[model samples]
Target chain A: MTPLLECRSVTKRFGGLAAVDDVSCVVEEGSVTAVIGPNGAGKTTFFNCVSSIYPATSGEVRFEGVDVTRLAPHVVTRLGIARTFQNIRLFRGMSALENVITARHCRTKAGVVASLLRLPSQRREEAESEAIARELLAFVGVAKWADSAAGSLPYGDQRRLEIARALATEPSLLLLDEPAAGMNPRESQDLVELIRRISKRGLTVLLIEHHMKVVMGISTHIVVLDHGVKIADGTPEAVRNDSKVIEAYLGKEDVT
Target chain B: MRDRIVRLLVATLAAFLLALPVASLRGNSSTGFTIVWTPAFVTAAMVLVGGAILFAAVEAQRRGTAFWDARAATDSAVGRRRPCAAQAWTLGVLVATVAALPLLGLPGAWTKLLLETMVFATIAVGLQITIGMAGLLVLGHAAFWAVGAYTFGLLTVHQGWNFWIAFPAAGVAAALTGLVIGLPALRLRGDYLAVVTLGFGEAVRWVIKNEQDVTGGDANLPGNIVPGSFRKPMGALGEWLWQPAAVDGRTFEPGTVQALIDRECYWFALVLLVVCVACVHLLAKSRVGRALFALREDETAAKCMGIDTTRVKLVAFMASALWAGLAGVVPAVHRGSINPEMFDFNTSVLFVAMVVLGGLGSITGSIVGAALLWMLPALLANWFPEVQEYRYLFFGALMAAMMVVRPEGLFGGARRKGAA
Candidate 1:
């Protein structure tokens, strides 16, 4: 099957420093792909390039054979790619349900006049959006806090809510940036199950994770990066034993 | 301790500034036998009251409390949901009181004051859509108001058009102008947007002033906008409601005709206010409203959620300007004239002040703010007409004080803190 997402020679430069240099990768349909690296490994930059948050300095990004390298972030999202931020950027003052319902922006077709008039079709769309948002919030286990402000939720639930919000977009490929970052061990274990369950839902998952256990425990395919360069790519077991992957994590001589 | 001292100093300085006019006028009176004591006592009273507020604010800040938690008080007083039986009862009572006030033999001036407040309340409700809900700070609202008023005034005077026909036409004209400004202005955010909009207001006034033939220049159009009688077919309802009687060479009842017309105008304005409030309230509860709130909270995150931020912002601008446009017709309809001066920067600032004071994003808050501010001057005009002249200065001081003490406004919405 054709890859769901393909990044060819993607490079992002920031004033003399190449944040993501000559990086190329493919996310196959319905597969769980993990991109792991050290602190400055360009994992987030690579994601940014693909999501069109930052246009790649060189190279192309194709989603299901359609070139979307230069598309705006919202346009990219409309093309079935949704992502969570590394810093948990929920609409702070909004309720959890609102945060999720807001993601249905592209899916819902109600305009200002229709909404103002409370047209039957608009009301139906709104009710449906609300129902879907509530279901997603429940799926993430923060359904009880649906009416509470998103920022006021506990840290773990906030992360879950972000995931639920991303899921609300109904994207084909979901990109999670450090989904397990700052999460406790138990939470990370739960996140692993969640990712597995999400992939089982027939959606392709691409995630950047620092928790080795979560990465090794869930990802079907692994690609490693170090200093803006791709160091390894294979199945979890093969990538785990690769010399360069080991060298990238630890010093070369120390690994030897 | 330091904060208290700073507050004390600021309060004293404000008192001095506020008293400067009174003090300067005291000795400058050409007639040396002026009643200076009344002015002096009023100034002192204002200073003392202002000092008390400053001290209280300082105490609240020191105690690490929500210094501006008026939202709780207001929420309790006017319950958020309108459909609640108690709220509905209260609303019915309020509406009845307003409707009956003119018939109760109240002074004509007071009725005029109430009508003015309703007009401003309507305008503020429109402004709340953009500034309060959409998280946009538009300073050119008065320009749209001016455009509507001019359009209405011109069409009525020159073309001999009826009031009903000219009203919607004026609104559309202003909306077109709003589109013209909004397309370019929406690209800039926060202060830049404010500055550009401010420029738009001045630009509009300048254009009107230069277009001497059409707009009548700075002298203003005269009293030609004679309000046409709301005629209905001779039927039982019309006979019962508006029975024409011959008295003192007039077809309608002697003194009651003018009073009835005034009452009719009041009713017309009231209906418009209710419609504006209902529409704005409904819009705020809709999907577009939620999208606006999301965009206001975080543009980038909203974008990642697939919101077209530009389209949203532009829509907000146009909608807001549309309200101002509709409101612009009121003054022309009421006063029967239009002038470039009527749409000054001070008018724009007053609308912003109303939004900020009422609580941004809260519909009732905007209405209350506009009503309170408009009524304040009307009530005080008989006693201190001089104070009415310095309205903008007072508004500026009030806004500054609000920023320090109650930045979230009276009925707090989202804590709008970020500059961008």
Candidate 2:
């Protein structure tokens, strides 16, 4: 079968600097793929290109065999790819439940007239969206903060809320950027368990993380990048033991 | 305890001093400055000072907390609860009272004022969609209002279309204008969008002012476009139910007919206000509203949630402009005239001020804001002509004070903690 997501020599440039340069990778269906890199490794930039937040300056991105390189960010999302930011970007003023319910935008269809009229169909869709949002919030373990403002939630809860919001879009491919960045070990462990649970539900996850425990703990496959170039791709155990991956993380061995 | 007493006394004294209108700056060079305390000023000062002292004493005895602190607490509490039956009842009672006003022998001038207030209220509520909900700062909203009025004026007066036909057409015209402007303007965000909208507003007004023959330019619309007494149509409708033969022979006096027409117009405006408010309230609670709120909060996040930000923003713009257009028809039909000057930048600012003062995104707040900002000035002018000279100054001071005291607005719910 074709890979769930394939990037064929994708590149993104800002001015003269190539942030993500000619990097190609594949995310297999139902695999928990972790993209690991040191700081300035262009992991986030690659994610942006794939999600169409910043369209790649060169090459292509295909989801399930269809090219989506030129699609708008929203269209990319609608086509079953949802992502969380490196920094939490919830609808700050909205309630947690509202944040998740808002992600139901693509799944539901109700226009101005139907809304204004309070038609039965609109009401049914609204009820369904709310129910699904609540369920997602519970699944992420932040159900208690459903009515609290998303911005006011505790840090760990906010991360979980963002994950819930992404999941509310009902995406087949989930992109989690630095999900464990600010998390404590206990929280990151819980996130690993959550990822396992998510993958068990048959959804593929493509995460960019620096936390070795998280990347090695839950990811089935790992892709390593350093200075915008991919150096290793394989099962997590193989990538972890690779000499180049070791060199990229701990600097090159001196040839004295 | 002594310090508190001293503070209270000093506050009362300051209130008295501020209320005293003793100083004046004359425009003429010969008589530059003068201090004259008229008896009216003295009485006004005394009454104001007494009221302030009484209020302070009562407040000190009752809650002991600052007024605004208590108010904020209650506002948050109310905001948390979902809209319940009690709110619907309150709305019902308020509507009933307003509907009963003209029939209970409300004066003609007051009826007209209430009618005008309803028009502004509708516009302010509509504006909430863009500025309050979608977070689009459209400074040129009055351009849509102008489009609605002109469309109705041109169609009814020039083309001889029926009032009913022209009215809906006016709304459609404004919505089309909204779509045209939104297509380009929505691409720009925040302050840039605001400037573009402001320019669009001025451009529309200038077009109306310059297109002399078509719009009558600086002059008002051609022909007496105002409907001659809403009475005839109302009376004909009443006749269908219960018309007394004895009353028919009398051919009701012109004054009585005019009063009836005024009452009918007032009811019509009231109904429109109710419909607009209900529609907006419903829209705010719906899925589209969620998308709008999401868009307002964060465009990138909203897009990641699969929301088409551009399309949602356009929906908000068109919805708001549609209401403004519908509201634009009321004055043209009831007052019987349309002028480009009527829909100028000042009117747009006033509508925006009403929305802000009432609290962004608050439906009832919009109506209250419109009534306070629109009616208060007119009422003050009638009751205290001397204060009329300082109307704009008073308005500016009130707005500044409101910002300092309650930046979220009187009815605005407390925003999330740390939100900019």
Candidate 3:
């Protein structure tokens, strides 16, 4: 079967620096794929290009064989790609539930006039959105904090809230940038289970992970990058033992 | 229960103490305090009472006192029945009280001032949609007001159009101007947006000032903007609607007719204000409204949620302009005059102050803010004429005091915590 999301030799540049340089990857349907590299490896920048937060400088991105390189970030979201930032960006003033509900914007359509009139359809959609938002929060284990401001949430809860918000978009593919960044070991362990559970739900998850244990344990496929170049791609075990992957992580040192 | 009584006594005593000096200062006789109903004294008393009640309520909750248990029990009971049933009931009572004000037999001037307050309330509420909810700081809001007022004034005077015909045209003209201004300004955020809007306001003022042939420039526009269609009081319906009800015995004097018109205009403005409030309340709770909040919070995140940030911002600008535009009809129809000086930068700043004072993102806050600001000035003029000369100085001090006391505004939304 065709991969759910494919990046075709994508390149992103800023001035003289190439943030993402001639990188390519394929995320299989219903698989947890990990992109791992050192700092400035362009993992987050690659995610940005795929999510259309920044348009790719060259080449294309395809979702189920459709070119989406030129689409706006919102349009990309509508086309079933939703992502969280490397740093959490929840609506600070809004409640966690509202943060999730806001992500359901494309899925729900109640314009100003219908809302003003309080049309039956609009009310129904609102109720449904609220219910879904609550459910998503619960799935992320932050349901009890639903009414609390997202900004005021504990760091772990805020990260999970961002995930819940992304999930509210009901995407076919979810991009999580550093899903385990700054997380404690226990939290990272819980996140591994969450990613596994998400994959079991038949949604493709492409995550950037720093924790080697997380990338090795849960991700079915691992893509390794170094200096904005994709150096290794295969099953987790295959990518781990590759000489280049080891070389990228450590120094070359004329490895045999 | 014991704590509640003590709290109530404390509040009452504080109110009395606060009101005493104010009442005594305004007393006609300096030697001995005599009960007098000067505007400033009455205002002082009201403010003190309100402050006392708020303080008591807050303190009671902090102390875990039984002072609120009774009210909370009743509130929960009401809340269980329907989500906003208590609010609906409170609103009904408030409307009934306002409607009964004329029955208390206030002087015509006071009634006229109250009508003017309603007009400003409408404008402040309109401005709230942009600055309060959408998080767009607008210094050019008065330009939209000018568009509405001048459009109505010009149509009724020069074009000989009726108020009924000109009213909607004024709103449309202002909305269009909002759209035009928003298209460019929305591209810039925060301070840059403010600068663009400030320029836009000045541009509108300059156009009216220089285009003397049409606008009448420094001189005011001609009179008779309110339609005469109801002047004869329709046959039966008109007479029933506006009977020119006997006020102080004799009717038909110029002052009497103006007073009667003031009463009629008060009702008109009240109805419009109610409609505007309802519309604002509805819009603020809608999906579009949430989108605006999302846009305000984080534009990039909002866009990632599939919200067209630019579109939402533009709609907020137009919606805000529409409210202010519609409100402009009152001043035009009431005064039958239009001039560039009326829609100055100070007027824009005052409306902004009103929105901030009322509580940003709170509809009721905007109304209360507008009413307090407008009413306080009038009352000061009545009881302390000399202070009126230093009106801006007094307003600046009041604004500073309000900021220190309640930066979120008197009715700021729970979500607007930590908001500047």
Candidate 4:
């Protein structure tokens, strides 16, 4: 099968330094992939380029083999790719359930007129969206926080809420940027298992992580970048043994 | 359990307000300044009682007092609290009391007062779009009103155009002017936009003043709305309009022009009021409305969310300008003259005050706020002329007290249920 997402010869520059320099990679269908690099490694910038959150400097991004490099984030979302931010950008004032339910706008077909008229179709869609929001929040294991303000949740729960919101978009591909960051070791372990479960559900997943263990253990394929250049790509075992991959990890293969 | 006390406080306040005109019977009507003390009693009673209750509520919650039972700090109680039956009852009672306005006092001026309230409400709705939903400060709403008045004045006086077409034409003209103002909004934020719009309002006034040939400068536009319309009172315009209108030879001196204008405007204002309210209701729930709220929350995030911020901003600007345009025509028909002096800095400020005092982002609040501010001055003049000159002083004092006490207008926002 064709890859679910592909970036070819992608390059991003900020005046002098290339944040993502002519890198190319394909996220295979129904697989969990991780992009890992230390600080200033361009992984997040690469993610932004593919996610359409920022315009790519050059190159093409294909979502399920359709070119989508120039689409706006919401349009890109309509093409079945969604993402969670590193710092957890939940709608701060809205409730946990509302944060996820808003993503249902991507799927809603009922117009404002229909909603105002209280049409049966609009009512049905609203009911369905609410149900899905609740179920997704539960899937992320933060269902108890559904009625609370999203901002009022603990940091760990907030991260889970971000994942819940991303999943509510019903994307064919899901991207998580540092979802495990700042979590304690136990929370990180739980996150790894959750990623495994999400992958098993046949949702193609791409993750950007700084933590070595989560990236190395769960990712079906691993890609590494150093100073905007793609230095390594292959199976976790193959990428781990590459000398440049070792160098990109600051020569700490034992830990990586 | 404690709902009854709040209900009782509201009732007592209404009773005092109804009795205010009796106390004002002692004062003469000509002067521009005086404090109507009977209404002052109502304001003071509200302040003292409301302040005490708020203090008690806050203190009780702090000490975990048993009397203030079940007051959870959980936001469900305050932020997203549903409007209950008590709320519905309060609205019903208020409407009924206002319905009795002419019966108790001000018998002849009931329609006039109601029509004026509705006009301000329309202007306030325009402010709600620009300031409440879009989070843009518009201290210059009167500019749009002026734009409408001039459009109607120029068209009707010079071309002898009927109001049916000129009213909507004026609306579109104001919207275009709003679009011009909206261009600079692309670069400004918060108080900066407010100042620029304020300047724009002054510019509109200046243009009207200098163009005496067109605008008649400071002179009122002689509102020559065809006379036979109200005098007949048999057609569609007078259907639901209160009978025995101001010029229906009820109590007015026979054939007085003021009574004629007043009578005709009663019918015209009623029609416009219904249209204005309905139009605002529709606009509030439209696609543009959703986009406006989203932009207000975070412009960058809204853009990232795939909403076109520029398009939404332009819509809000037009929405505001159009309503003010519609409202501007009311004064022309009411007074029969559109003067450049009518659209000044102070009128714009009053419109802003109506929106803020009502509730930013709330249609109901805007209506109530508009009515309160608009009527405060008039009520002082008619009911208590002794307090007429000092009416604004009382208004200022009341507004300040409200800001401290409730801060969220009389009704707060038009509720958006299930919105997170």
RMSD of 1: 8.4
Candidate 4's C-alpha runs over 4 A off are A109-124, A251-256, B1-93, B107-118, B151-203, B210-214, B222-290, B357-359, B364-420
Tens-digit lDDT track for model 3 on A118-228?
899999999999999999999988999876668888888889999999999999999999988899999999988888877777789999999999988888899988889
DockQ agreement of candidate 2 with the native complex: 0.51
Candidate 4 chain B weakest lDDT stretch, 10 residues: B69-78
Sorted on lDDT, highest at the top, how do the candidates line up? Answer: 2, 3, 1, 4
Runs in model 1 with CA error above 4 Å?
A: A254-256, B1-82, B222-261, B386-397, B414-420
What is the TM-score of each predicted model, taking all chains together? 0.82, 0.86, 0.85, 0.74
- Distance from true location, Cα of B157 in model 4, Å: 5.1
lDDT (0-100) at residue B245 of candidate 4? 28
Q: Pairs clashing in candidate 3?
A: B233-B238
Q: What is candidate 4's lDDT per residue for B54-113, written digit by digit as tens?
A: 433543354354322212211111123223354334434444434333333222354465
Reference contacts reproduced by model 1: 0.61
Question: What is chain B's TM-score across the candidates, in the order shown?
Answer: 0.73, 0.76, 0.76, 0.71
The lDDT for every candidate, in the order shown, is 0.74, 0.79, 0.76, 0.69
Most lDDT-accurate candidate = 2
Kindly list the per-residue Cα lDDT of model 2 for residues B1-420, writing each as its tens digit. 553354344333334333432111111212222234445434444544444344434433343444333222122211232344544454465466568656545556666777899999999999999988888998998999999988987887677666678878999999999999999997899999989999999999999999988888887776333332232545453221111112323554534654666677788788888999878877877789888888878888898899998899889999999999988887775665677898888888898899888776777568767877887787667657899999999989979977875676655655644753
Give the alpha carbon lDDT tens digit for every residue of A91-164 in model 4.
56556776677666567665545755757887687789889989999998999988776767899998998888
Model 4 CA lDDT for position B191: 90
Q: Residue pairs in steric clash, candidate 2?
A: B226-B336
Candidate 2 regions with alpha-carbon error over 4 angstroms: B1-82, B223-233, B236-257, B416-420
Candidate 2 chain A worst ten-residue window by lDDT: A144-153
